[model samples]
Target chain A: MAKYSKFAAVGLLLAFPLLVSSDYYRHIMILALMWVVIGSSWNLLAGYTGQISFGHAIFFGVGAYSAGLCTTKLGISAWWGMLIGGPMAMLFGFVLGAICFRLRGTYFNLATLALAEILRLVAKSWVSLTEGMMGILTIQTFRSKVPYYYLAFGIAALCVFAIWAIIRSKWGYYFVAIREDQDAAEHLGISAFRYKSISLLVSSFFTGVAGAFYMNYMGFIDPDVVFSLYYISIMAILVAIIGGAGMIWGPPVGAFIMVLLQELFRSAFFGYLPKWISEAHAMAFGILVIVVIRFMANGVVGDWVKLSGLFTRQKAPIPSVTSGN
Target chain B: MEMFIQMLVAGILIGGIYALIGLGMTLIMGVMRIINLAHGQLMMVAMYITYVLYFYLGIDPYFALLVAMPALFLLGVAIQKYFLNPLLKIDSIIPQNQILMTVGVGIVLTETIRFIFRSDYKSVKTSYSSATFMIGNISWNVPMFVAFGLAVALTAGLFIFLLKTDAGKSVRATAQNKDAAMIMGINADWITQLTYGLGAAMAAAGGTLLLPIYYLFPDVGSQFTLKAFIITVLGGMGSTVGAIVGGIVLGIAETLGATYISMDLKDAFGMVIFVVVLVFMPGGLKELTKV
Candidate 1:
């Protein structure tokens, strides 16, 4: 029955574009698909590998920039970005991992954050290559949202499948072992550094591809949009955590929820609410993050049993202190 | 040579305020073992408080320091008591929940300030803001000089408090080892809250000092947050003395970069130094000082 439901879900997603005619909804779905790729990749590195990076935007921006550079500098079709962006991001990931993996915990996190900030600064100052804050604009290859929707769906599906495969493989166990106890894993003869680098490489590749796709679909690229700490990096973490980190289906679920909720707030409850509500959308996003972290740290998928139990069990029994006494 | 000296002087003066900010962060880092990503946002909140007092009440920015510091202290305590402390008990997949919580706190603080004040750049233009005094071949901005003097005084006061006071000793004890401190009848929880408050107050002092010379905006906190961490890393994490030296070094480096290199890359200089320090001298200036 579960397998059938999975198939049904995929079938629905495949037919979504045909069933939905509104370009706005389609656009939101496309963005959601893009986030699925990013969030899942982030989950692999952070949730599975135990390396919480605050700098996924580095890969995403690199991929987008690579694609953007292709059009501006190489005078090639942006479609070639689809081919080149992943490897380029992976190469950067290797360098970043080499530099940052030596540090543990908060130090590692800070190092990645520094790298992202450095990249953003470089992209901004290197106007000769990146065009600075003016941003890079290119003509979209296709006018209709339908083609982009399918492309995005294909990529998201491919990413999900690839992650699912990896998680089920021996490498998946190795990743989990490292996350659970890095020192113990190393003592057991697993090279923590090697597995971590592998996880980061795979994670960076998918994020890069998603970024390249974003450049193709959006037809505009800028350092701030791609490398933004809040919008891209934090948003990726939020999507994974909000849906459920460390769970196979978590990030995909989170991607849809985040994108839809953002749309709902951005549109001010679909224009039924006051226009000023739209201005507070970012605040709402911030509040959502706080709420999720505080109340649902394990996320909806990870804590499904607990959440359902809360609803079903109207009165939670208090433990009697008299027994211990 | 004259220009270089002038830049050095300016850097050292600004570095005094930077030290105050770094000291706060290092204190929090020492106790909590987590980098308070919201450190700058707390400073931002204090700056807004100072701005409000200066704008509406005609209070001097210097006088607003008292008001802002205590207000931030309370704010910091509340954040620790309510938002951060509760997470310690909850089991989560992400081990870095506290750090992430700080990030969320930062976003909320920035957005809330944006909601209330809007994003237009605001600054307090005191008569002394642009006032300068020339000595030899170099000149010193009057406000910056006053701020540096106050900063040094505050640092000295903090040292005395830490060394001589019972409460401050408890904080130090807790930071050294929570279990041992608790065994010695210290309320580790209370110490943590107090430490967070003290850290925020120090950051507030830094922000208030900067207000006379710097522009105030909701987003300004993030840049300062980055600077604070760079100083923390440069000084060696959790080392107060190291933070002071790190702050001065960063300030000089930035000033020199702005003067000799492109102004656009001024921020990058700190990052370059940070990476170099991380790779070569992970222990930071604290290792060299052995203090």
Candidate 2:
């Protein structure tokens, strides 16, 4: 029954664009799908590997700029960004890992954050190369939201599947072992550093691809939007945490909910409510973060039994299997 | 040579205020063992309080400091007692829950201020705001000098408190080892709240001092938040003395970067230093000074 529900959920997502003719809803779905890729990647590193990065925006922005540069500097179809962006992001990730992997826990988090900020400053100031804050404007290939939605869906699906596969493999065990205890993992002959870097590399690649897709779909790229600490990096963390950080399906679930919640607030409950509520959308995100962290740190999916148990007095049936599996 | 000295003086003046901000963050970091990402937002709240008192109530910004500091102290105690303290009991996979909570608090604070004040940049103008004194070739702004003096006095006062007072000793004990402090009959929970309050009060003082020279806006808190953390890391995580030196180094580097390099990349200099220090000297200046 659970398996059937999972299939039904995927089917609903695939058919969502066809069901929703409104470009606005489709646009929201597309953005949600992009976040799925980014969030899942982050989940791989921080949730699975225990390397909490506050700098996912570094990969994201680097991937975006690579794509943007392909058009302006290299004079190729931005579609080549789809090919090059991931690898470019991976290369930078390797270097970042080399420098930052030495630090553990909060230090690693801050290092990544500082690196992302530095990248933003670089992108903003390197006007001749990045066109500075003027931003990059490219003609999006397709005018309809349908193509973008499908593309985002395909990429998100691919990313989710890839992460699911990685977690099921030996690498996934190593990642989890490291998360559980880095010292123990090392004692067990797992090179914690190598596995952590591998996790980061895979995580960064998908995030970069998502950033590239964002550039193509949005038809714009800027330092502020692409490399934002609050919007991109923190948003990635929020999505992963809100959905269920360690769970395979958590990020995608989180992405959809967050995107929908944001859209609902941004559109002032689909224009049913007053306009001023839309301006408070960011505040809503902040509040959601606090409430979620406070009450649902394991996330809705991770704490499904506990959360459902709250509404009903009846004891929730104890599942034979844990969600961690 | 003249340009160098002028920049040095400017850096030192700004560094004094930076030290105050760093001191607050380091205090929180020491006790809680979590970076208070909301440190600058707290300062921003205090600055707004000062701005309101000045703009509407006809109080001088300097006089507003007394009101803002205590208000912020109470606000900090409430946050620590209510928001952060509650999270310690919740079981979660992530060890950084408190840090993430601080981020949420910062965003909420910034957005709330934005909702109330809008995003318009506001500044207080005092007679001393533009006043400057000349020492040979270097010019020192009068307000900057006064702010610097106040920062030094506060630092001295803090050192006295931390070194001499029982409450201060308990706070230090809690920071050093929570369990040991608890065993020593210190109310670790109360000490945590007190430390957070003291940290917020210090940040409030820093914000009030910066009012005359700096502009105010809801988003301005984030810049200072980053600056505060950079100073904390540079000063060696929880070391008060280290924060002081780190602040000065960051100030000098920033001033030099603005003068010699592009002014736009001045902020980047601190980040660059942060990364370098993290990689090469993780213990920061505190590790070197061994104080």
TM-score per model over all chains: 0.97, 0.98
lDDT of 2 at B284: 94
How does chain B score by TM in each prediction? Answer: 0.99, 0.99
B1-291, model 2: which lDDT tens digit per residue?
A: 999999999999999999999999999999999999999999999999999999999899989989999999999999999889999998777789888999999999999999999999999998889999998878999999999999999999998999999999999999999999999999988999999999999999999999999999998889999999999999999899999999989899999999998899999999999999999999999889997
Interface RMSD of each: 1.0, 0.7
Best by TM-score: 2
Candidate 2 Cα misplacement greater than 4 A, ranges: A315-323
Pick out the ten consecutive residues of candidate 1 chain B with the lowest summed lDDT: B275-284
**Model 1 alpha-carbon drift over 4 Å, by segment:** A314-325
Candidate 2 colliding pairs: B235-B242
Error of 1 at B201 (Å): 0.9
**Ten-residue stretch with the least lDDT total in model 2 chain A:** A316-325
Candidate DockQ values, in order, are 0.71, 0.80
**How much of the true contact map at the interface does candidate 2 reproduce, as a fraction?**
0.61
| Worst 10 contiguous positions by lDDT, candidate 2 chain B | B90-99
Task: Give the lowest summed-lDDT range of ten residues in model 1 chain A.
Answer: A316-325
